[model samples]
Target chain A: MILLEEVWRTFQVGEAEVGALKGISLAIRRGDHVALVGPSGSGKSTLLHILGCLDRPTRGRYLFEERDTGSLSELERSALRQSRIGFVFQFFHLLSRLTAAGNVELPMMFAGVAPEERRTRAQEALRSVGLAHRAKHRPDQLSGGERQRVAIARAVVMGPSLLLADEPTGNLDRASSREVMELLERMNADGLTLVVVTHDPDIARRARRVIRLSDGTMEEEAP
Target chain B: MRAPDLLRFAAGALSGHRLRTLLSVAGVGVGVAAVVSLTALGEGARQYVVNEFTSLGSNLLIVMPGRVETTGSIPFGGVTHDLTLEDFQALVGRIYLIRSAAPLAVGSETLRHGDLGRTIPILGTTASYAEVRHLEMASGSFLPRRDPEEAGNEIVLGTKVARELFGGENPLGKLVRMGVWRFRVVGVAAPKGRSLLGFDMDDAAFVPVRTVMQAFDRRTLFRILLEVRSRGEMEQAKREVVRLLAERHHTQDVTVITQDAVLSAFSAILNALTLALAGIAAISLAVAGVGIMNVMLVSVSERRAEVGLLKALGATDGQVLAAFLAEASLLTGAGGLAGLGAGLAAVKILTAVYPAFPASPPAWAVGASLAVSVLVGLTFGLWPAYRATRLDPVNALMRR
Candidate 1:
C-alpha cells in the first residue's frame, strides 16, 4: 500500500546541513501491522511524518497506492491525507473546547459529510471505542485512556485505509497503555493497515513486521 | 466544512476564551457607540436650527438698511440711511404681492411702574408686525390698528415685562412710564423665549413705529419686515422690493434677505459640521479595530496546537483562513449591534434629560456604523488569520 525508494529528508540548521533521514527504502503491503522502532535522533518520527504525507522528502520517490506523492500539489496532498490516511498523536491532540463526539466528528467534517450523518457516525465511532456514554465530555474531563480512545475513534471515523500512530500510549499508565495497544491491535486485525512508531519493546514485538533505524539510516528489518 | 458548521466551530472556539472575546467585542461596541451618539448630537443640532428658522414664519423677507454688496467703484464715505417708514408705506400700498409690511424701530429704555424700574428693549412696529412675525398676544390687543399718532401713546408689554412689572395682577390698562412718555399698557405679549442673537423676545415691549421714531428723533427705520403672499412669490417680491427701494432712495442701497436663502446657508454649515463630527467619532472605531487585531493575533498564537490538529485532519489553508475571518466578522457584527442599542439608549437618556434636545440618530448613521465595524474586523484580522494559514502542521504539533 506504501513504498519509499531511497527517500532522504534534510534540515538546514544554521550553517549545518542535518540529514534526518538518509537513503531509506521500505515497503509495506495492505493490512500489515508495522512498527518503526528507533532510539532518539534516529529519524523514527521523521520517517513516520513522511509516510503520513505530513512532510515531503528531499530526494527520491514516495509512492502511496502506486501513485507518486512527491509530485502532488499541496491541496492534492491534503485531500489525499484526508480521504486515505489517519494520524494518532501521543498527546491525543483532542481539541480541548470540543466534546469527544465533536473530536470524533472532525475528520468527517473535513471530508464534507452531511451534518445528520456525521452526528450518527460520530456516535457510532464513540460506541465502538466504548466512549458513547462520555460522548459529551471534553478531552480534559476524560481519563487518559478515554481521551486516547476518542482520538482513535476520530482517526477511524473517516474510514481511512492507513493509520499512523506516533507513540500513542507515551503518556498513559501501564494498564491504560495495554488497553490502547489492544484497541489498536484489534483495529489492525480488522484489516486497517496500521503503522506504529514506538520506543516500547512490548508494543514493537506485537507488530507483524519491525523496522529499526540508527543514525538516520535503517539498520535492520525483521519479518 | 459547510459555512454554518464553520461558523459554529469558530463561535465555539471564541466562547471558550470568554474574557478575551468580551474585551474584543467591547472594543468594537465602544467604537460603534461613539459613532452613533456623536452623529446623533450633530443631527440634533441641525434639526434644532432648522426648527428655529421655520418657527420664525415662512415666505418672509427682511429689508435692512446699508448696501451689503459693495463695489470698489462706489467709493468710501458713501453711507446712506436707505430704509424708512415711507418705503414700508410704499410696499403696503403699491406692491401688489406684498401681504403686509411692518416697519421696525428698536431702542433700549428704562420702564417705570410705581417703585419698580427695569431696563427693557422696546420693539417699535405697527399692528401688522404681530401677524407678519407670528407673535401671539396673551391679553387685551396687539398695537391697535389706528392712526399712528393715537397708537403711539399705548404700549403692549411682553410676558416677561408684564410679569416683572405687575406680578400676578393684570397689567392691561395699567400705566407705565418709558423715558419721558407715560404709556397705557393695552396688551401683554405671549412668551416667545429667546430669539436669535441672544435677545429675549419675551422681555421687551411693542409700540407704534412712529412713536419710537418720534421719541428717538430718528426717522430712518431699522428694518422693514415684508410678508409675501406665498412662498412661490418670494423671489418676485424680493425683486420688486429692490426695484421699489432703489427707485425711492435713487440707489440700490438696501439688502433684501429671503427666509429660504438664510435657511439654506444655515443648513449647509450645519451639514458640514455634522459630517466633521461623525468623522471625528469614526476614529474611535478604528482604534477599536486595532484592539480586535491585537486580540486575534494573541488568539492565533494561543491556539497553535488546535490549528495544527485541524490541518492534520485535512483542513486546507483556505479553510483555516476563512474560519478565523468568520470569527472576526462575527465578533464585530455582534458588537456593532450591541453598540447600536447602547447608542440609542444614550440618545434616549439625553433627550429625556433635556426635552428640547432633538437627539434622534439618523438611520444611515446606524447602518454605516455597523458596516464600518465589520470592515474594521476584516481589515485588522488579516495578519493573524494569515499567520494561522502559514503554520506548518507537523512543526506546529511538535512545538508541544
Candidate 2:
C-alpha cells in the first residue's frame, strides 16, 4: 500500500524555485501494477523517484506501508529504501565490470547478505528473469533485452515490496520490450507491486491501472 | 555493506581503468621505495658507527687530566694538576676493576730515519696498550714491558711511517731519531685506517710513555686509559676512580668517562641522521599522496553514474564514500607492498655490492613507510570520496 497526499516536489534552479511535481495525490493497493505516463517534462520520473524514496517531497505526506517517509531521517530513509523498495533505470545501469549474477547480487550485498547466500539468491533471481544461462555474462556481453532482465533481477533480488522502473525497455526493440514487460508482469502476478514510468503507450496499456501527468500535476487515472 | 564486498566492488572499479590504476600505484610505489632505501642507508651508517665504537673497546674508560665542565681555581689559578705517571701507577695498583691500563704521554715531533724526515704524531703508551686497544703488529713485537716511569729505547713504526722511512725493506731493528734520541724500531703497526676518535691510527708512531716524556721534556702524562673487566662495572669503577683521584689531588680535577658515553653520543647523532633521512623520504610519500588524490578524483568523476546507480540500489552515502576510499586504499596499498619489495631488493643489492657499509632497511622504517602509504591513501582519498557521496543521485542517474 502507498499513499501520497498533496505532494509538491520542487528544485532550486538558480534563484527560481521550479516545481517538478505539484499537489499530486494518489493511492495504490498492494500488488498493484501501475504505469505513470507523460510527455518529456511532465514529472513522471520525479514522481517515480519520490515514490522510490530516492528523493523526498517538498511538501507532502507520503506514506509507505503505514510508515510516514517524511518523518524518517536520512539513514532511516535509506534503510527503508533498501528493505522495501527497488528501482530500475532506463539505462539498465549495470556495472560494466560485473557479470549478470554480480549485478543481481549488488542490492543484497548492500543489504549485508552473506556472499554465499547472495550468490545463491542472485542466481535464482537471474533464473526467474530468464537470465539463468546469461548469469556469467557482463552487461556489455548481453543483448539489450537480456541486460534489462538482469537489471530486473537486480531490482527484485532483495525481495522488495515495491519496484519502480523508469523506462525499463526504453532502449530495447519491440520484441525485447514485450519480453521485459512480460517478465515484470509475471513478477507482479506473483504479488510484487510494480510502478513503471514510460512514454510508450503500449507499455502503459499493459499495466492494470495507468496515471497520466501533464506539466507538474497528475491529469487523470484510468482503470 | 560487508567489508569484503565493499573492497571487491572498489577493486572491480579500479580494474576498469587499468592504466590509471597502474600509474597511481607506481606513483606511491616510488615514494615508499625512496623511504625504505634512504632509511636503509641511514640505518646502515648508524650501525657502522656503532661497530666502530664497539671495536674501540666497549669497556675502556679514559681519565682526562682536567674536567671539561670545570676550570681550575676560577680561571685565575695555575693550570689544573696534570695527570702524572704516579697517578696512572696508583690507579693501576688500587682499582681491582682495571683489567688493563694504557698510560699515554703524547707529543708531536719530526722523526728521521737515514735521510728521510717527516713530522708525525707520537703516542707514548705502555705495553698493555696493544692488548687493550686490540692493535695488530705488522712485524716484530711491541714495546717491552717496563716500569711506567722508566724510559726505554724501543720504538714501533706505523704502517705509513714505516713505508715512508724504510720503503718496505723491513724496518725492524732500524733506528729512528726523534728530538735527539735514536730509538730502534722494534715493531710496525698494521694498517688500521682512521679510528672513530678522529685520529689516523695508521699514521702515528708509538714509544714507551717515559720515552716521550723524557724526550719532549714533558712533566705530566697525557691521559690514562683504564680498561674495565666488564661493561657492568663502569659506573662503579668511575665513581671509585674519581674518589681515589680526588683524595690524592685534593680536588676532582679529572673527567673520567667510559667508552659507552662517547658511543652513546655517536649513536644519538646517527639516529637523528636516520630520522632526518626518513623525514625527507616521507615528503616524497606526501607528494605521492597528492598524486593519488588527483587520480582518485578523476576516477570518481568518471564513475558518477555508478555512484548514482549504487545509491538507487540502496547504498547509503557512507557506503559510497567507503567504496571509493577502498579503491584509493587498494591502489596505494598494492603500491606500498611493491615498493617495500623494491626497496629491500635495492638495499640487498647495495649490501652485496659494498659489504662494508651493511646497507639494510630498519624494521621501524619499513613499518613507518607501509603505514604512511596506507595513511596517504586514506588522507588524500578523502576529498574524492566525499565528492562521490555528495553527488545528487537524481541528477547522476539522469546521465545516460
Candidate 3:
C-alpha cells in the first residue's frame, strides 16, 4: 500500500543545503505492521510525515495505494490525506476545547460529512477504542492514555486505508505505552496497514518487520 | 466546506477568546453609533428650519431690495434702489388678487418708559401687517386701520416688551419714547415664540411705516409683504406684482421670492450639511476598521497550530481562509446592528428630553452605515486571512 523510491528531503538553513533523507527506497504491503526505529536525526520523523502526506519529498517518487502522490495537487493531496491516510502524533494533538467525540469527528468534518452521520461515526470510533464512556470529556479532563486513545479514534474516524504514527508512545508511561501498542497491534491484525516510528527497540521487536535507519540512510533490516 | 458549517466553525474559534471578540465588537459599535447620531443631529436642525418656514404663512411673497441670485443684500455695492412705500401702494391699488400689503421699515432704537429704558428692534408697518403675519393681540388693537402716510401715532408692544416696561399694569394707553418721538401704545401683542426675518418678534415694537420712515429720515422701505387672497392665486399674484413693479420702475431690480422657493433652498442647504456631517462621522468607522484588522492579525497569529491541525485534518486552504473571514464579518455585522439600535435609541431619548427638536436618522444613512461596516470587515480581514492560509502545516504542527 506504500512505496518510496529514492525519496530525498532537503532543507536550506541560511546558505548551506542540509539533507534530511538521502536516497531512501522502501515498500510495505497492505495489512502489514512495519516499525521504523532510529536515533535522533535519523530521518524517521521525516519519513513518517512523507508517508502521511503532510510533507512532500524534495526529490523522490511516492506511491500511495498504487497512485502517484508526488504528482498530486495540494488540493488532491489534502483529499488523499483525509480519505486514505491517518496520522497519530506523539503528543496526541487533540484540540483541548473539544470533547472526545468532537476530537474524533475532526477529520470527517473536513470531509463534508453530515452532522448526524459524523456524530454517529465519531461515537462508534470512540466505542471501538473503549472510550465511549469518556466521549463527552475534554482533552484536559482525560488521562494521558485516554487522550491517546481518543486521538487514535480521531485518526481512524475517516476509515483511512493506512495509519502512520510518529512516536506514538514517546510521551507515555510504560504501562500506558503497552496498552497503546496493544490497541494499534489489534487494528493491524484486523487488516489496517500500520507504520510506526519509535525510539524503543522493545516496541519495534513486536512488529512483523523492523527497518532501522542510520544518519539519513536505511542501514539494516531485522527479520 | 459548507457555508453554515464554516460559520459554525468560525464562531467556535471566536468563542475561545471571549474578551478579544467582545472588544472588537465594541470598537466597531462605537464607530457605527457615531455615524448614526451625528446624522440625526443634522437632520434635526434641518427639520427645525423647515418647521419655522412653514409657520410663516405659505400664501405670502417677499419683495427684497436685491435679486435672489445676488449674495449680499446690498447688491452692486449698495447702488441698487430699495423698494418704496409707493410700490406697496401701487401693488395693492392695482392687483385685485392682493388681499393686503404691508410695507416694512426697520431700525434699532431705545424705548424709554418713565425712568426705565431698553434698546430694542422697531418694526414699522401698517395695521394690515398684523393680519398678514397672523399676529394675535393680547390687549387693545394693532396699529388701528389707518392710511400708510397718515402717521397713526399708535404703537403696539410685543408681549416681552410690555412685560419689561409696564410690569403687571395694562400698557394699552401708556406712552413710550423712541428717539425724541413720543408714541402711545395702542395694543400688546401675544407671545409668538417663532422668530421671523432673523429677529425675535417678541422683542420688538410695532409702529406705522410712514411714521418710522419720517422719524428715521429714510426714503426707501426695507421690504414689502404681500398676502394673496388664496394659496391657489399665489403664482398669478406674483407675476402680476412683478410685471407691475417692472412697469413702474422701468426695470426689475427687486427679487420677488415666494415662500416655497425660500423653503426649498433652505432644505437643500441643510441636506448638504447633513451629508457632510455623515462623512465626518464615517472617519471614525475607518479607525474602527483598523482596530478590527489589529485583532484579526492577533487571532491569526495565535491560532497557527490550530490552523495546521485543520489542514492536516483535510481542510482546504479556501475553507480555512473563509473561516477566518467569516469571523471578521460576523464581528462587524453584529456590531453594526447593535450600534444602529443604540444610536436610534439615543435619538429617541434626545427627542423625549427636548420635544422642540425632532431627530431622526435618514434611510440612506442607515443602509450605508450597515453596508460600510461589512465592507470594512472584508477589506481589513483579507490580509490576515491570507496569512492564515499560507501557513505551512509541517512547521506549524511543530510549534507548541
Candidate 4:
C-alpha cells in the first residue's frame, strides 16, 4: 500500500516556474486495479512518475508500507524501486542487444541474483506470458503484441507488489490492445496491484477504481 | 557486478555494432603501433652506438688535436694535423696511467694476392698495435720489433681479407701487392666483423709504421690510440695526456677523450632522438583519443532512450557511468594489443631483411604503450560517460 499527502511538483522552464502537480492526495491499496485518466498536459504522467518513485514531489509526505519514502536517501529510494516496484512503458523500451529473456532477467541481475536462478526465473516469466517460444528473440524480432507481452513479463519478473504501466496498450492495434489488457486483468486477478495511466475511456472502464485528473488537479475518484 | 557478467555484457553490446567497434579499436591500435615502433627505433640506435663504443675497448682513450665544436664549422678541417709523435711520446713517458701508446697512421690502397685484387683499408703502426688494440691472431705471427726498424715488407691479413684472397688455404709467407709494394703475408688476424660505422674491421691489412712512412710517403699523424691500465684510471690518464699534449703543442686546442665521454655523447644523441619520436607518438595518441570521444558521444546520443530505460529499471547513476567506461576501455585495450602485435611483426620483418641492423622492441616500450592506451581510454571516455549519467530519465525517455 502507498499514500501521498499534499503532493506538489514544480518545474522551471528557462526563467518561469510551472507547477505540474499541485496538492494531490491519494491512496493505493494492495491488489487494487486503478486507472488514472486525463487528457494531454493534465499531469497524469507526472503522477505516474511519482508513483513509480522515479521522481520525488517538491512538497509531500509519501509513505510506502508505513516507511517515509520522502525522507529516504537516493540510494534507499533506488533500492526500494528495485525491490518492490515494476514499470512498463508504451514504447516497450527494451535493450536492443538483449533478447526477451535477457530483458526479463535485468531486474534479477540488479538484485544480485545468481545467474542460474536468474535464467530459470526469466524463462518462467516468459512462459507465463505465452512467450516461451519467443524467449530468445529480441524486441525488434517480436510483433507489437508480443513486444508488449515481453514488457509485461519483464515488469513482473521481480515479483514486485506494485505494477505501474504508462499507456500499456497505447501503441498497439485494437486486437493486440485487447490481448495486453486481458493480460493485465489476469495479473490483477492473481493478486498483483496494478495502476494504469491512459486517456482511453474503454480501457479505463475495466479498472475497479477510476481517478480522473484535469489541469494538475484530481477532479473525481469513483469505485 | 561480477567480472564475468560484465565481460559478457560488454561482448554482447560491442558485437551488436561490429563494424563501428572494430573501427574504434583500430584507431587505438594505430596509436599503440606508433608508440612501439618509434621506441623500438630509439632502442635499436642506442644499442648500436653502445656496441660501437664497447668495441674500441673500455680503457681506451683517443687524443685528437683541436677542439670539438658543438654546432659550428671547423676552420682548420678538424684535428687532422694536430697530433704528432712528440705528443704520443710525452703521454706514454710522462703519464703514469698509460699502459701502452700506439700511434696510428691510416690510409686506403688496392691490394693484390696473386690474381685476386681489391681496394682495402691499410693501417700502419708499430708492433705494439696488437697489444694496444687487443688484436687476436688466427694463424702466423704479428709484425716483430725488428720488422718496423728494418722496414720489413711484411703484412698481417685480416680474417675476411685472408678468406677473400686465399679461401681456406694458408696465406702466410705469400707475397701480396700493396700499392706496388710486394709484401709477404706475415700473419692472419682474427675475425672482428664490421664496426658500427658500417666499415669492415676484418677486411683491412696492417703493416709496420716505418714501412708505411717510407713506402707510402704518409707523414701526417691521424689519431693517437692510448690504452690505460684500467677503467678507473681513465679520467686521470686523460687529464695527464691533455696536460702533456697542451705543454708540448704550446696550445690548449687539443682534446683528450675517454670511452665514458664517448658513451655519454652517444646517450645524449639517443635522448634527443627518443624525445622527438615520443613527441610524434603523442600526437597519434591524441588523435586516437579524439576518435574515441567522437564515437562515444555519438553512441550516447543514439542510446539516450536506452539509458533512461535502464535508469528507470533501477540502474544507479554509477552503473551507467561504469558501463560507458567499460565500453571505452575495452575498445582501446584491444587496440593496444593489436598495435603491440603489429610493431613486433615490423621488428621481425626488419631483422629478417637486414640482419646487421638491430630491431628488437624492449620490454619497457611494450609496458609504456599499454599504460598509455588505458590512460587515453579513461581521459576520452569520461566526458561522454558524464553526459550520459547526467541525462534526466524523463527527458531521455521522451527523446525521439
Kindly list the per-residue Cα lDDT of model 2 for residues B231-302, writing each as its tens digit: 899899999899998888888889887777777888899889988988998888899999999998998888
Clashing pairs in 4: none
> Ten consecutive residues with minimal summed lDDT in candidate 2 chain B?
B70-79
TM-score of each: 0.90, 0.96, 0.86, 0.80
Pairs that collide, model 3: none
lDDT of each: 0.87, 0.89, 0.87, 0.82
Q: What is the TM-score of chain B alone in each candidate?
A: 0.89, 0.94, 0.81, 0.74
Residues B334-387, model 3: lDDT tens digits: 789988988898899999999999889988888989999989988898889999
Q: Write the per-residue lDDT of candidate 1 for residues A118-206, one digit (tens) a residue.
A: 99999999998888999999998999999999999998888888999999989899999999999988998898999999999988999
RMSD (Å) per prediction = 3.0, 1.9, 4.1, 6.0
DockQ of 1: 0.65
Instruction: Compute the lDDT of residue B374 as modeled in candidate 3.
Output: 89
Per-residue lDDT over A87-170 for candidate 4, one digit per residue giving the tens place of the 0 to 100 score: 888999888789999999887776678999999999999999999999999888999999999989988988888899999899
lDDT of 4 by residue, B333-395 (tens): 888999889888887888798787776767877998888887888789889989999888877
